[model samples]
Target: MSRRRRLRSRMLALVLVGSLAGLTAVGGPAIADTLSDKRAAAKKQEQENAAKREQLAASLEGLSAELGQALLDLQAMEQRMPQAQAELAEAQESLDRSQREATLVAARLQDALDQEVSIGSTIEQDTARATRIRESIGQMAREAYKGGGTATSMDIVLGAKSTEEFIEQYGLVSTALRTQTNTLDELRELQAQNANSQARLEAVRGRVQELKAEADEKVVEADAARAQAQERKDEIQQLISQQAAKKAQIEDQKAAAEAEAAAADAEAAKIAAELAAIAAQQRAAEAAAAAAAGKPQAPAGPVGGSLFANPTSINPMYVTSNYGMRLHPTLGYVRLHAGIDLRTYCGTPIYAGRAGSVQWAQYRNGFGNQVMVDHGLVNGSSLMSSYNHMTSFSVRSGQRVEQGTLLGYSGNTGTSAACHLHFEVYVNGGTQDPGPLLGR
Candidate 1:
């Protein structure tokens, strides 16, 4: 009975040991598979989150660039505002001066006209007096002729009685003839004076007409100048208004971008924290798996290469100018030509020279509608590219682009004299010849 009891106890202990071993094998595999599934799901979530983060980062970079550009533009506009105001003031001053001169001229003309009128009145009075004198002289001559003309003097002398009387008659006749002669001479002198006055009046009238004409011309010039000045003032005001509106728009965009960036940053931080936790858990699981399997981990893959490609698809007709010292066409002085000028028809499509982020894409002062790209690093040097005198742009600041990506269209904007592409390559913030890079 003791031997049978010992055998049953040993069999029950063996069965219990077998059941515990089977439970460990099945339950351990199930728990490992559950952990692995959880790890995979977490990794997948992490990858998705990483992709989202990358996208958000790109967007944030673009927004920052846009904000920077906006600030620069606003500053530039602010600077130009004073210059425009100064120009307007100068124009107004010139217009005012012209108007004052015109007013003076007009006053002078009125004075000349008044003098001419007064001279005309004096001439009319002189003419009337001369006519009256001529009529009186004619009447005297007719009366003398009706009274027997030259014989009247002799009859007067004969009508004297004695020698004394005859002497008196002769004296009387001589005296009367002398008086008539004096009167005729006086009338002739008056007529000559009237003729001289008329001639002087004609000259004065001509001078007055000339003065009036000059005054009219001055008034016309002043009116034109005033009109031009007004137009310029209006244009400047309109430009200021436009700049203000643009600044406001940029401010709004910047505010929205900042808000978005903040949200994205928070979300990315949350995702990073979750990823970190997941990574720690995964590392622990992997380490455990490795320990269980007694194997080593594989290495990661290699990184990709960074090389540039041609910017545009279309072949240019010819290079208009190469980078070097040359005389400027419009500026009329020796200056450094910092870029290669590529001649092409207006509205030609422009492309990116390399895969990079856009630094700026807007209307620059001298460059016109320009686009600048930041090629992070190439050939162990920081590189950048710029396209100037563009008519329009397709890309915005901080946007990522690939080689041959369309950036804009060629134009004759800003300081450009003709339609062309001004291509520049910058190395370490200094301009360099792009011929070698372009393989031209």
Candidate 2:
């Protein structure tokens, strides 16, 4: 390699050594635990279905016929904007962390490769040194054989002219023997070191392969995180845009909604009110019956369980919203949905719930084209049923009708938005939950 390239390689190899050493010193499990915790937390947030539902339901439930509904729309929008903004912030943070992880993984992969290259170089040097040692040792042995091995101590002493000459010959032989011994020892040490480095190089290469895979996964995770963040950002922006338009819409509908509510309020109260028209009709009917008999009246029949047939045009009736006190999520005010709202199309047939007298079949103030049917005495009280929000009526007041008598056509009239049948069951005068009565 060129000088510059070699220098760069060395630098990278040094980085690899330091990084790997740190990892080894800390231990793999401890290092993995930190990243594992973060990843687990991010994965946990993947189940955001409930949050999505809350957002969707809140947005949809706010638009209805009541004036409170328009006001509800505003409140729901207020709640959603802030919630979306907060989620967006979290998503952005997660994206940032994932990107950092990707970058770290890329660096580690490169370092592992550098460590493998550097270790391979060390192994080569060791092999070269061992070869040189072997050649040198071979030459020394051949020279020794040519000279007939070594002079004995007795031979040295006898051949010597003086004590100094004997000492000098002994010293020369000792130095030659020591040189061969040192060379052989060094060759053995180099061979052992080279084997160790070869193993280490293989391990480094394996680690490089592992790091490459981890790097790819990190890249994918970072991209997904970025997409999530972007999606949240776009959603928040859309909500912001809708916020202004919704507020303007509420202002436009405010007067009409208010008028509708005002008209419906008194009639709505009468459904559950003690001083209701149904109560008066009940009292009058009982008096007329007693006078006809000229004796005490018979005990009323028992009323429990499913007391009425399906009153909707649907083959099998389906209730859209149940009868209960529904509190607006944002407004925190409870409103009574006094009856069950059934899924009915515009101009669909509306049935009498049971055999009864058709008392009123005209447009009541809030009920639009309303039809009230008196089911007569039941369980010592008068039972009545009302089918409201119809386009037109077929029956009139004082008409005797059998069960399933077609009274009107369903519509989106009065304080209603969509086309449906609002069915109410009143015992004596007060309206109650119609679930039990409606179920067949």
Candidate 3:
């Protein structure tokens, strides 16, 4: 009997020990819960850091593109400037050529006028001499005709003492009369020819004057054309100046944008460093906690929930899509998926993820009932987030909301296959991947 009691006591001790082990197994997870929580918080911070980094990168790229375009504009303006200068030079050359031709033509016209004046003087002198000679010949003819016809007949009928005397007297009378008539005729003809020559010379002089006037007019026209061309060049130069000023202004804007982007990049880096440090600290804490409890560290931080500070269930949960490339439900082909989709029962409550002011609330083509919130300006610019596809809204367009405040309800109001939330973050006006910021 004594031996049986000892064996029973030993069996009872074994049973007690087995029961204690079972209770410990059941309570082990609860004991290590704090470690899990710490790890999850760390991971959430890291995810936010990554999202910020992406935003910074996108801003940098856009700034770079703007700067490049500005440079091209400035270069085009520079090119136009040279062309305008060349055109101006050409216009000046044309003006100079016209002026020189006008000077030469004026000199030639003066010479022609001088020659015509000398020729006119000579013609006037010749005309006066011819008139005097004709008047003398007319007087001699009148005197000869004054002798009666009977006296001229008797002198011719009476023979001279000798034939020689008669012949000489007759020859003398005839020669004198013929010479006077011929002299008068030659003077008249010379007078007529001199008048004609003077007329022709005057006509030539008039033509020279006309040529001078025409050349002067042409010079004036060329000068006007040159002036017009110069004016055009000036206008082009003015345009180039304005364009250059505009380019400078745009360059200033680009510089400002680049500075802003750089600042954003720096801030993102700082945030990432803080997140990494926090994660390391949490990991250290978790390691200590696990050692103390003598169990494996719980898999902290849910797969998609490691990126936000306060992740909570404000609305009923459903996952419609996940990250990475997937065949688009509506686009009908493979496309890069930037974020995950959270579906819910139609009209279910949707809540704010953080404290912020409502920036905009409206309907969009694909997003339907969209709501954008401006948390605040970061690195010299606004940091905004948007939520889309809602059946109804709870908040006004510019209402402020704290974390977990009701924002709207889920719906298929947009280009959606079903009722779901389409969320996005923006550094400026561009879209960014929302997966990191949506972590829980």
Candidate 4:
């Protein structure tokens, strides 16, 4: 906006030069044409400034909102990070527990397998011993049958040669029968022990298989827990990285915004100084006029409470942001807002706050299309009010306007985050809060 204004001022200078040249050599018609051409150029430049100002306003508006959203997202991510960490920890613990269980089950499986193998070996040995004993008994019975077919006590008595010989044979027969009976009973006991060993081997084999399956399941559980922990860890890391990026971007944007805002502030101060000088001149001119007519000066102090009415068509006006210092959330740097932001939709009608002369209805840097009203004097002080960031104005510089006269339409035309009215009140050429001065 300022650049265009400077260019326009330069163009006006060129026109002045042309006018001087025309005065010396050219006729009145050429001077008129030169003036007309300059006016056309000025209007074109003003239009271009309006376009650029609106474009700048639109582009800059979303930054504050973006910063706000980025800050919110960062805060939410910070809050979520702990929860994700806790979930990862919980998963890690689960994996550890599962691994421990898998190890124990594997150990138990090995033990059960060893036990089954031992029982099987024992069963094989018992079967071999039983078979050897049965074979020995069969060989003995075959030998007795092949030699005499009978070794009973009756046969021994019948075959005896003498009384003493018969007695010895009878004793031999009785001892042999008793030995056979004991041998058969031992074989039967060995068979029964082999059967019990086989049963125990089968039980141990089943237990070994069961342990193997349990160990496999524990291993699977451990793997699943490990995967879950890794996933959660990755999610947390990604979230942290994204939040960091957003914060950095927001900070960079805020830095740029702060710079722009500072420029706007300086511009406002310059404008205020210029207004003060103009007011001093106007006051001197008025004093001269009044003295020439022998009239008293305007009232010395405020006779009424407030000198201005609400500069808006909206009833029950609302304030969006108060005129004061605004602080950056992370930067901790302060910037002046300089004016009260009133709630006004785009194109909302803006009315004159008090009867005054319009200083300018044009774009002024970051303020966009603005209207400054110099309400001569109030409460023995120079008073002024400005309506900023308007879509368009109905009044022009030096135009007399009455209180409640339609001035312009509110807008988001310059350095605004949204559609609203930046209303400023000045007392003795210094900015003051407009809230107390504006009518309720």
Candidate 5:
């Protein structure tokens, strides 16, 4: 009976020890596990919130950069428009002057032609007068022949009945002959003068024709020059029109971007506030639980967050687009985006997202001057990052860089529609959604 009591007591002691171990496991390890799980869940939620915030920031940044570049382009075009207008005005003035000169030349040519006509009419009249004089001389010679060649002053004196009559008849015949000779001589002299005048007029007409031809040539040349100038002015105007259209489009985009950015920022702020509230609640609950259980509270801050830093010094305002399948801006087709687009202006500094060695630093097709970094590994995965559309780069292929290291300046190179950064993340050898990796 004594031996049976000892064994039962030993068994009772073992039972009590097992019961206490079970209680300790339920009260301590169970509570610790629950707290740890809660902390992990909260950290995950926080990371998701951070990722969303980052996306918003990138979008705002992209929009701002696009708007700024558009404004700059518009300003440059506006400044050049005035110069184009001035050139057009000058061209018009030149054209007008040419037309005026042409008109003057035409009038001069008409005057020259009129003068030629007048001179020709005078020559015709002079020619007719000469013909009449020749006919009259022929008639006088016929009359002299019909009256007999011997009918002279001596015959007139012989036929006279008295001395006075003889003297009068002789004087009359001599006076008639002398008057005829003088009239013929004057007709010949007038004909010769008319012929000389006609010759001079003909020479003047020839010179007038030459002058008119020269004037006509000048008019043609001036017209051609005016047309050329006008065409040039028109081309400039066309260029101005194109630029204006581009400016308008940019302005519209800017307005939209600004509105979107504002909304995104507000949303992000709201989300951040909510996350903060949740985090505070989680912290308070954890503290309360720890106090009740007589254990330490869970640590604060993000857990298993992104290792990469922002690729820019300034915090991005919003995300333009996330890496995924989307419609191409220019190609009008569904395609893989393969990267995240961040808002950035021309000349904005670009930085490495993680410490790595540069795999490539050169101009790439459709990506512009790009920098690709091989980060070796992150979270047991081979990771890589690329920065695209840079204006200039401070790093080179085979070079080493730390996180946040300046790589280059942002730009609108390659096939980009605006100035911005195309940030890409890779896992192993393939592209992946950069959102989660960025703690989005």
Candidate 6:
């Protein structure tokens, strides 16, 4: 054989050996179509899950808004209740005070009336006494005139036997005259006093009447205020009841959302398991081919020659770095890497390794433009994958997307040495080898 032919045969033998070494790692070709069908179905399911998540998020937000409004309204009602109760209590207390005042005034008026009656009786008695005294004086005058003017003061005085008796008689006569004059003056004074007392009693009676009237009006107003306050209290209670019902509804919604998320997780796990099985079968086929060729095999990891498509298919032999290595290009330190870096040109269209829904698409710290996808259920757990270091991103949060959709263009935005895609697969929340499954 020619020297060039010998080199070519040796290279082909090396390729065959590498294929056999990786065969048992994945599924075979007999289930390729089945696995593809399942992956398509899983993609559709993931899209549905994305839509459901959006709906649940919106519903939760609306419930939160309503709950907040209800709480505010309840607080307002609670604050008003105290004021209303205070007003009602003040009104009631005022009514009570007025009623008590009315009672006191009525008692005072009764006392005044009794005093007026006593005064009137005393005036009547005084007037009767004055009349009797005047009649006695008139009779005395008639008798004296009948006896003619001969019966004088000197005769009257001489009628006494001794000088002391005559002086006594004179004193008695003077005292009678003064008593008559003073009696008339006293009668007039007593009448004036009685009139004043009656006037005062009337005034007191009027005040009592006014107080009684005011008390009745206050009672009426207080009753009305109490009734209004009671109505308001009842209304507030009704609102509280409605809020409780709304809270229960929100709880129900939350439960449903949690259940949907659980179902999506379980479904994703199943799909991941199926994809793993198919990949194992394909790897087994490749390994069988390598054995028949009889050549040395390469290590089972990401390699340039693989069946998977890349963001840029050109220069497939160049690998930027291995996944589990150390060497921070930007920070200049040895750190364990979580994902493989594939070298590619800028603006390369990144594709999904397996079917999945767009879980997240946004700019993140240290990742710049990135996209994470939920592939499907595998082994009773959800499998997720991430594509980072992209120049541009098209998907949005809560967006529904399918496999093979244009994620973004490749770029070196994160901690990278060159423009490449940082690919990662997560199995049950832990990172796994994605290169072999992608046939890289």
> Which has the greatest lDDT?
4
Off by over 4 Å in 3: 1-77, 100-104, 107-115, 142-159, 225-261, 264-440
TM-scores of the models, in the order given: 0.46, 0.56, 0.40, 0.49, 0.47, 0.33
Q: State candidate 5's TM-score.
A: 0.47
- Report model 2's TM-score to 2 decimal places: 0.56
Q: Residues 1-440, candidate 1: write the lDDT tens digits.
A: 67434433433332232111111111111112376785775576457554443322212121344553454455456544544554555455566666566556656656666777887888788778878778877887898789777546568666767789888878877887887788788778877877887887888788776765666566556556656666656666676787888778775775555454455345334433443453345446555776789985332222123334555445743565677766422123454566676656688788897888897798755566878887754443456788877899999999999998999888766544456677877664566788767766
lDDT of 4: 0.71
Q: What is the lDDT of candidate 3?
A: 0.56
Q: lDDT winner between 1 and 4, please give it.
A: 4
Ranked by lDDT, top first: 4, 2, 5, 1, 3, 6
Ranking by TM-score: 2, 4, 5, 1, 3, 6
Compare candidates 1 and 6 on lDDT and give the better one. 1
lDDT of each residue in 137-226, candidate 4, tens digit only: 899889898997757677777889999999888887778788889889988998888888888888887886676567656756866886
Clashing residue pairs for model 3: 44-306, 305-440
With candidate 2 superimposed using the best TM-score fit, by how many Å does residue 103's alpha carbon deviate from the native?
7.3
The predictions' CA RMSDs to the true structure, in order, are 36.6, 10.0, 36.3, 25.7, 35.5, 32.4
**11-58: candidate 5 lDDT, tens digit per residue:** 333223211111111111111137678578557645755454444333
Q: Which regions of candidate 5 deviate over 4 angstroms?
A: 1-76, 225-244, 256-440
lDDT of 2 by residue, 328-417 (tens): 433345667677877788888888888989878877666767888888777677788888889999999999999988898898776565
CA error at residue 98 for candidate 5, angstroms = 1.9
Q: After superposing candidate 2, which stretches have Cα over 4 Å from the reference? A: 1-118, 138-162, 256-351, 358-370, 374-384, 390-400, 403-414, 418-421, 424-440
For model 4, state the Cα shift of residue 126 in Å. 1.3
lDDT (Cα, tens digit) per residue for candidate 6, span 1-440: 97434433433332232111211122112221376875775576457554443322222211233332433344444434444344444334444454454455445545554665675677577667757767776776786579673334787576989889888878877776777678667667756765775676577667645644554454455445445545544554565576576556545555443444345335335544644664455455556766888944333442222323453434553445555645421123444455566656678777765566776787654454678776554433446677877888877666665666677788756433245677767654556666764665
lDDT of 5: 0.64
